[model samples]
Target chain A: MQGLAHQLIAGIATGGIYASVALALVMIYQSTHHLNFAQGEMATFSTYIALTLIQAGLPYWVAFLATLVISFGIGVFIERIMLRPMQNASVLANVGVFIGLLLVFRNAMGWIFDYTIKAFPTPFDTGTPLFGGLVSGHELGSTAVTLVVLGLVYVFFRFTKLGLGMRAAAFNASSSRLVGIRVGWMLALGWGLAAAIGAIAGIMIAPVVFLEPNMMLGILLYAFAGALLGGIDNPGGAVLGGFLVGIIENLGGAYLVGTELKLTLALGIIICVLLVRPTGLFGRVVQSRV
Target chain B: MDAGRDRIGTGIALPAAGAAERSAARPLRLLGLLGLVAVAAVLPPLFASSYQLFQLTLALIFAIAILGLNIVTGFNGQISLGHGAFYAVGAYATAIMMSHFDLPWWETLPVSALICAAFGFGIGFPALRLGGLYLALTTFSLAVAVPQILKYKGVEDWTGGVQGVFISKPDAPEGLGLDADQFLYLVVLAFAVAIFLLAHNLLHSRIGRAMRAIRDHSIAAEAMGMDIARIKTRTFALSAGITGLAGALSAIAIEFVAPDSFSVELSITLFVGLVVGGVGSIVGPLFGGVFAVFVPNLAESISRAAPGVIYGVILIFFLYLLPQGFAGFPQRIRALLRRRPEG
Candidate 1:
């Protein structure tokens, strides 16, 4: 019973991180209806930037803030420069470009940072357990960070004028334009916000996984499953889905399929969820017009 | 050449080639294409070293795989980022049969093809519910999970775990008395040509038109009495079957199969091949195969450690400059030339 308690805590902590990434995915999907295959790589690249800043003697929080800003700019620039021209291209062409971005970000990280795994610094002292030994300090710290980011994102979308414009654009671009929204800028802003969110996820995950070029590959798969589970188009559902996936993955890896088949377990969940509820648990049914 | 002349004259008079002209020119164009293939088939043996022949064989093998990808993705408009899993299954099917059952390498092709088709069909059921991006994600998950599944302890006995399985290269038949490299090249060429021709015919059939209609507008196609689900699943099966056959050939060519060999990167490479060669074109996969085999060597020559970055740059450049891919380059040139005459 004690062991199970520890695993559940650990799963929730990791699920919090997955929730952050899944929310980023949902943000882009909501705006563009395209799943950014490069989302994980972009996050990894931001985390690496943070690593370089820390190595160069900046404080951890300072590096984290700077990384977030730079990542946002990078995301917006990618939208304005690369993806804008492809806005009217075929789905295949757009997918090709996404894959291109993924290759560039991932291999560029490998080339610039080298492939050797490195230890990431935790903001909290991780030597001691927290919450009566159920969670480590790092786990508690990271989950708090993830929750804070999620809260801010919700508030931003719910209250801000720019957020409303972005939502308007995503729901209907021409309608938004008719209502005097700058749809193009709204799309760019969406990318920037999603990138910032992804950076936070990467930073939180780095300390646990140890930073490396391929660190996010498995986590990204989980995030995909989570996003699909909750609803690829619904932020709230995706967040819930992420937490559920993390717990399911932990328990499934521990008791059922074993750790060796953990990734396969993710695949199984994605297929099942997709087959059973294509709109996801919380998503709206998409209507196709003739 | 005569067809070109006829079309050029048509620009000055009629809109384009009429049926009579098309009929007259069809046999000539077919002969020309065949003649090119004949030259390609015969020349490598005459001048190249054995190692070069082996490289060519690998290229042909990749061409076959890319063509398979083209069937579902290019023609049928389904995006699969996990065809690598099918390739791996096919290779393993051959590897298990050859090593455990002591089956002849040539005899394992059908078994491998059948197994991969079955897996594709199983995957297709779930795919029937998913659309473009969702299907891509599901397939991507499959690609990411494949290596771990192959390395699972339960299958370690057959999979050889991390060390992977290796088989000896098939020898030349006794009557042929050819070297190993020569024999393998001929075998791959025969398969490549046969499959290419088969895909060509498949894409031009009534079913092919239906696939394209679905791609253009699925609702309209459905309203037009097309069975969208059936066409898609069957296309997926065919695509997997063709790629699996290629995998069997690739296993024979490389003489080894490992989980690492079929990582998500392999799927990306095949996707890159399809894009760089030109999607939705019959000849595109042939060029794609060449790109898949040679570009890495080119990248390696430029930088020892960062071939992937180089590949990424080249891919971006292709997307930016030649979005129609190399296969469409000739038509772009022709269009330009035709406009020049008018100007």
Candidate 2:
């Protein structure tokens, strides 16, 4: 019972992180209908930026705030500069653009810093356990932060004027434009919001994982699988999905196979999900208009 | 050589041999292309050093693989991220056949190509129902799994595990005045040219038209009586077969076969090359092939780690600035020049 309890708790902690990242992905995907293949990589870059600032002797909170602002700008700039040009391109070409940005973002990160692995400092001190258990404060802190972010996103989408405009533009650009909404700004704003959310997730998760150029590739896969499983179009579902995937993966490795096969197992689950339900557990079946 | 001259069928731009050039001019154009191919086929043997001979030879073999990728992704508009797996299949097929059964080079290469094509078709058949990202994920998973299958302890005795197979060079025919490296390069160059010529001619066939049509609009093509599933499977087979052929030649050139060589990194770079070179044009594969040769050579000139970083950076830069690729550079410059005179 204790071993199973430990497994479930560990899974929940990891799942919390995955859910946070996946929710950001869900936001972008919901608006654009295109997967930002560079989302995790972009997050990694933001975290690295924060780490660099903090390393240069800035306070953690200040550095975090500054990085968040920069990340917002970066996201908007990406939509305007890179994506705007390839607006009507074929699917292959559009995907190519995302891949191109991914490369640029990751390579720039490598170029800027030493390109070596660095340990990010956690907000919580290293001495204390969370709940008379072996789990650390950092994990608990991450889950709590993720919940707070999710709640904020829910409130923004549910209650705010700007958020409603963003959703309107996403639902139908033509109608949104006709309705006097600034559709273009809405798109850019969507990217900015997603990037800011992603940046927070990045900073939160960096302390748990090592910071490197290729660090996001693995996490991106997990987040993607989680997002898809949770229903990519639903932000809430995406969060729920990430937590479920994380827990299942953690417990599966602990009980059945082992750690080395975690990726293969994750992929297997994704394939199974794809086979059974292409729209995922919570997604609506979108009708193609072409 | 001008694309305009070749476009004799009005704005139709269909893949068949142009109606206007169906006479003596057509044969002459074939001769010119063949002549260029002939020179390329012979040049590797003329190089004195084995290193130059080896790199160019590997490039020739890789050209075949890239060309296959070109046809599938560039022309057919089906994105494949698992080409290196097909290459691995071909290499292991050839190596296992040669080492275990004492098969000669002549027999091994063709058989390897066939088996890979068949295997490719098999993988493609089951997965043909999928679309877009799903297809890509399936292929990526396959690429990751194949090497593991090769390295599995159950088949280690046959597949050589992680150490892989060390192949002996084939004996030369009597008094050909050819060293083994030079000989292998020449043999590979012949098949590569054959592939290029066939692919070139193929783009002029009904199948080629079907491929382009599918790329442009699959639903419309299906309405127009193009069998998407059959042709798509065939595209996978042909692409996989060419990649496999390249793999066989690569195995001979390296005289070694290991799972490590055909990593996901190799797949990424190969796809990057295709994108950076231009996807749909005939010159695209050639441009990608040149980039393939130059990037690593340039990397060797610089530091070792810089290659991946540099390659990624260059690919991204070109993708943002020139989506069409290096082949499109001249046209872009010409457009700039045309505007500058008036400006």
Candidate 3:
């Protein structure tokens, strides 16, 4: 019972990271109707940038902010340069471009940062457990950070004028453009915001997973499962789905399949959700006109 | 006839070949194919070194695999980023059969094909519900999970876990007057010729038209009384079986099978090969296979990370500039030539 509780808490902590990544995925899917297959790699690149800044003697928080800004710019740049031209291309072309980006970012990280795994320092590290030993200090701190980020995102989308415009553009680009929404720019902004969110997820998870080029692959799979489970198009549902996936992964790894098959477990979850309830728990049914 | 003569006087032929021209070209095309096959069967074994023969064998194997991918993704419009999983299954099946059951390498090919086809058929069921992006996502996850599944404890006895399974290379038969590498090359070439011929026939048949129709517009295809689901599922099975056969050949050629050998990267490479070779082009996968086999070595010679960077850049650029890939290059040339006369 005690072991299960510990696993549950750990799962929640990791789940927070997955939730953030899933949220980023949903943001892109909602806006562009295309999943950024490179999201995890891009986030990994941002985390590496943060590491470089910190290694160069910048404070942790400052490095974090700088990384976010850089990642945002990259997101916008990629949208304007690579994706905008590809908007009207075939599905294979679009997928090819995304896969290309994934390869570039992932390999670039290895080329620039090297493939050796490095310990990432946590600002919240306290060498002690918290909440009656239910979670470690870093885990608690990271979870809190994730919640704060999620809350801010919620506020932005729900209350801000720019957020409303972005939503309008995503919902119906032609109509939004007629209303002078600058739908193109709104789409760019969505990409930037998603990139920024991915950076946060990467930075938060780095300490636990360690900083490495391939570190995000498994997490990305889990995030995919979470996003699919929550509803690919629903941000809130994706967040909830992330937490659920994390818990399920943990409990299942411990009690059912064991750790070796955890990634496979993620695959199974994704396939099941896609097959049984593809719209997910919170997503709307989308109909294509013939 | 006067206009045709005048156009030829400008050193540029018309965009479409006349029926008479096509008929005149048919025998030449057949002769060219026969000559090419003869060259493939004869030149490498006779002139090339053993190492070169091995590399050529690898190219043929990848060509077969890329062709398999092309069948579904190119012809049927289903994007599978996980075909490597099928390849791995095929390779493992062959490995286990040869290493455990002591089956001849040729005998294991059919078993591997059947197993991979069943797997593809099962996967195709879920695929029926998912659209392009979702299917890509699902297949990509499958690719990512394959290595882990191969390493799982339950399958470790058969899979050999991290150590992997290995089988000895087959020797040349008595009185063949051939080395092992030469014999293997011929065997692989024969299989490649057979598979490519089958694929060509399949793609030209009524079923092939239905496959393309579905790819172009599913609803229209269905309205034409084509059974979309059946065609799709069968296409998936056919594709997987072809790719799996390549995997079996690879096992024989390489004489090794490890979990790590069939990583998600292999799938990506095969997809890259498909695109570069020209999707939906019967002869394109040959170029794709050669590119898959040779390009990495060229890239890696530059740097350890060069392969990925090169693949990424080439993929993006090719999509932008050469969407039809190398197979379309000749058509592009003809189009340009025709445009010159107009200008």
For lDDT, the strongest prediction is 3
Across A1-290, the per-residue lDDT of candidate 1 in tens digits comes to 88788888889999998888899889888888889889999999999999999999999999999999999999999999989998888788778888888888888887788889999988998887777788899988998999999999999889999888988999999999999999999999899998999999999999999999888888889999899899989999999999999999988878799999989998999989878888889988887765
Query: Compared with the true structure, what per-residue lDDT tens digits does model 1 show for residues B1-343?
Result: 3233334324444334565687788899899989988987789977889989999998999999999898889878999988899999999989888988899998999889989988998887786656668778988899999999999999998999888898888899899868888888988999998999888777778887788777767888889998898889888898999999999888888889999999998999899999899787788888999999998988887654466776677677787788767887888899899999789
Q: Each prediction's Cα lDDT score?
A: 0.87, 0.78, 0.90
**What is the per-residue lDDT of model 3 for residues B181-249, given as tens digits with 9 covering 90 to 100?**
999999999999999999888876888868887888888988999888888889989999999999999
**For model 3 chain B, the run of ten residues with the poorest summed lDDT:** B1-10
Instruction: Give the per-residue lDDT of model 2 (tens digit) for B1-343.
Output: 3354235223446455555655548788878888887787676577548888878777777678888888888777887777888889888888888899988877999899998899888767645555556555556556555655666666789889899999977755769988887787778778877888799778768888788778777899889998897888799889899889888878877888987887655666677778887777666777787688778788757654466667766766766677778767776888799999898
TM-score of decoy 1: 0.96
Q: Which stretches of candidate 1 lie over 4 Å from their true place?
A: B1-17
Model 2 clashing residue pairs (backbone): none
Q: Can you give the TM-score per candidate against the true fold?
A: 0.96, 0.88, 0.96
Q: Give the CA lDDT, 0 to 100, for residue A236 in model 1.
A: 96
Query: For candidate 3, what is the TM-score?
Result: 0.96
By DockQ thresholds, what CAPRI class is model 2? acceptable
User: Once superposed on the true structure, which residue ranges of model 2 sit more than 4 Å away at CA?
Assistant: A125-134, B1-18, B92-128, B137-174, B257-260, B299-306, B320-322, B326-343
